[model samples]
Target chain A: MIDQLIEAIIQKKSPIVVGLDPRFNQIPQAIKEKCLAEYGETLEAVAAAIKIFNRGIIDAVADEVPAVKPQVAFYEQYGLPGMAAYLDACQYAASKGLVVIADVKRGDIGSTSKAYAKAHLGQVQVGNKNYQGFPADFATINPYLGDDCMKEFEAEIVQEDKGIFILVKTSNPTSGQLQDLVMADGKHLYEKTAEIVAGWNDKICGKFGYSPVGAVVGATYPEELSALRAQMPKAMLLVPGYGAQGGGAKDVINAFDTKGLGAIVNNSRGIIFAYEKIGGDYQEAARKAVIAMKQDINDTLSSVGKQYW
Target chain B: MIDQLIEAIIQKKSPIVVGLDPRFNQIPQAIKEKCLAEYGETLEAVAAAIKIFNRGIIDAVADEVPAVKPQVAFYEQYGLPGMAAYLDACQYAASKGLVVIADVKRGDIGSTSKAYAKAHLGQVQVGNKNYQGFPADFATINPYLGDDCMKEFEAEIVQEDKGIFILVKTSNPTSGQLQDLVMADGKHLYEKTAEIVAGWNDKICGKFGYSPVGAVVGATYPEELSALRAQMPKAMLLVPGYGAQGGGAKDVINAFDTKGLGAIVNNSRGIIFAYEKIGGDYQEAARKAVIAMKQDINDTLSSVGKQYW
Candidate 1:
């Protein structure tokens, strides 16, 4: 899956992954009304609307991007039907030949962690059958619980060829409160996390010199992004906060290697909700938004002597 | 809800929360066969089997414990039907007057955090209607993203009187990797987290003096538990690592206050899977296990001159 994600980036000439994080209020009124007409002011209605909204965005951008990350929290807000819609979006994106990243941010210890690994990455077994719960090629995870806690996720990566991006430095303003704590060894907490990720990255590299294990260092912090990029050269980075969260193309330039193969920048609302700013058919607007983002990133990378082609 | 939990502890003379973390392999054969017969060898069968298994344990232990902490990982392995069963267990435990702590350990930042806060602790508004996704009195959350990321969860506690337990000092062997890191400010990471939890605890305390905001300290680390107890006096502690995690009654003794009202100890496999060792009806074994656990904890607390009644 890591190799496939890298392959897609080179083929598309775009190190971009659209984030399918739908806020019900931001959903188009026409789509919402149609769902409400069918399901009538219930969770099902909200989920149906999100399903359509996600399909529209995925269809528009699948031809231009390497991956699409569907955040579980947005779908989980509506309960079972919402999760059903989330799965539908993942499946639809995969059907379009795009790598699906389930941004669940799940982590725990021991067998409990293994259960989550099976939920998003591995397989579940019943009496005589096995089932894949959420079909994600990769999933995002929290790293507070430590390396031992992530052994199950590591096993899934090795056995099933799946991948995971562990959070290092988040995009939020106050993320520094904990992540920036200077350790007694004179290293920041995120640097320590980056070291841990780098160690793991060394264990599993694809033919292209990238590892299935990756780190998520938000593009909002360009200096940290560059520092972390240097710290974990072989680690593929999943950089959030690329657009709506106030991170510009120039800010994210540090995320990529000179080969433009080390990172995938994600923009959620900035791309999916582009119709609000551009004023057109949502699908066409979303398509145009993807092209614009691809051009913006590629042009910036080119200025730095970085190219995927 | 904090007061209610305190009251329940006093009434039952037990500050014990039975961990309803069901493992499919540990479920008795009879229940599995019945579900298999009804739903065949599908995820449906897995979910139905877990539903019955969970209900049996909930019925047995509800009378003896103040709460039941159902870890989400186990239920999530089966996807939607599994989640349906998880909700069923929460509803059933609540129906039996037990506080349902959804041990989800979910954390994200900003509106993403708000979506998760809504999923477990708050309600979602859809047009003129509102719906609660999962009926949990409290949900456990990770704290790696820092305090500001939890603002949405804080809002839910004030708005709906819900509760949350944030991980501080976990019981895992390698939890020290990140949690025990010595900061340049001369405080361990967990102490910093405890201070943060303490501040949140002060804002929304109930009449009994404990706050809806709590900390999860592992029973295996008794010394740290006692230290953190003094640091966050108003915050109730959810102590795991008891029994199956190798923490015994003696190891968890420091988790309580002089009034024996500051903490709740959890034991999952020790109680739910007791039938395998005790050799009896699963329900009866679980019931006996809960009573024995209650007695063990009360006896230890009484030895230190602590009393709830």
Candidate 2:
């Protein structure tokens, strides 16, 4: 799956996966007016507007990027109608030949964890019919419950050909309070987590020398990124905290393996609603921003003597 | 709020807060058939059935118990419509004058945590109108994200007369793998967390000598419960893993203070759907189970020379 993801990015020559976290109030007035006119104030209508807005973005970037990540909370805020819209958006993006990563940081213990795994990544039997869970190639999981809690999710990754990005180090500013705390062993908590991540991936290394089990290492901490990358050479890195979160392409360069086959950079707000910041037409601004990001990443990789698509 | 919770429980003289976790498949065949006949196969209908079932239990036991804890996951399994049913059930339970402790187990970083806190216990503005969140007297929270993640929730407790139970020692078998791991300070992880819980409750101590900040200590760990109680003398305890999880009322006695006024026992399957296990009429089985549990808890408390009720 990582190979397929990498291949798709290389073919498109863009690693951008537009994040659709359409905070209703943050959306541009023009889009909001149109959405309200079309759907009205009902939650369903609002959700439909969000889907339409996302579909427009997907339509414009289908051939330009590898995937789209829909943060589940943004949709969940609106309730069921929002969930239906999110599912629709995911299906639409997949149909456009783009991978969909469900950004739901779910973590639990044992059978409950299995239920969550089934609810999100695997099939769940409801009555006589077997309903497919969210159609995402991968998901982000919380690892605070410890490694034992991840066993069920790991089993799903093996049996079902799915992927997971365990939270090794998050992009949030206060994340370091707990994640960076020095353990008795002298290693930081995140370093300890990364070590376990590497160990967990050891049994699941793929043909491309990467593992289906991945780590979410923030792009905000470039120095830590390099150290973590060196420690977990086989784990794919999902680098958030890019663009809007103040991380540049150069900062995330060391996160990838030499072959540029082990990392995926994520820029949510910067790519999806670029018009809000860059001040141009929505599609044009998004296109330009994505192209610029691709170029910047390519330049960073080349400068580091690493392969770049 | 802890005073209210303790007083209500003591006044009623029952420790059990029937947990509403209606797994669609696990529901008895008779109830399922009746629900299917009444509501059809639609997710909304099934969720409505769950709401009705919970309402029935609340109505039957409202006078006998102090509270009802509704596990959010079971409702969330159906998505938005399910959440609506959850809201309906909570409102109905509250209407019956039963304290509703939403068993959400939610935790996130900063603003997101605040949003969840508001969505479950406080308030959030939807538009020109402000909409009430879950309106529960209390909700369960996961504290894995560290103390800062709880600031907003703690603020809500102060501002809104609400409460939160932090996950300290869980009931699941694998909980010990991470929670019981020895930390650098010679104390176990949960012990450290329990100490934090005590600190969080210091300023919020109620008239009844308990605080709004509570600890979720599973009934399965009696020794830990006794020790944790000693550590957090003023923090209320929500003891799960009772009845069906192989914990008797005796196992949870140590969680309470000497007055038997500091803990609320939770039994999901043992109370709500007792007919499935006891094999008789639904209401009859539920009523009998409630009576037996009440008696058992009173007996245990009496044996310990503690004043219950």
Number of the top-ranking candidate, with TM-score as the measure: 1
Model 1 clashing-pair count: 0
Give the per-residue Cα lDDT of candidate 2 at B237. 92
Q: Where is model 2 more than 4 Å wrong at Cα?
A: A1-3, A34-45, B1-3, B35-45, B132-135, B203-205
Candidate 2 chain A weakest ten by summed lDDT: A124-133
What TM-score does chain A reach in every model?
0.98, 0.95
Colliding residue pairs in candidate 2: none
What shift in Å separates residue A59 of candidate 1 from its native position after superposition?
Answer: 0.8
Give fnat, all candidates: 0.72, 0.11
Calculate candidate 1's fnat. 0.72
Model 1 Cα lDDT, one tens digit per residue, B169-235: 9988878888999999889999988988998987778988899999999999999999999999999
What's the number of clashes in each of the models? 0, 0
- lDDT (Cα, tens digit) per residue for candidate 2, span B1-309: 777888788788887788887777766677667777776666666676777677777778889888998887566556545667778878998998888998867776565577667667776444444445456889888766677667879777998899999889988776775567565566676887787788888878889888899999999999999999999998889999898888997799999888777888898888877888888766677788999998998888999988555
Candidate 2 CAPRI assessment class: acceptable
Docking class of 1: high
| Top-DockQ candidate index | 1
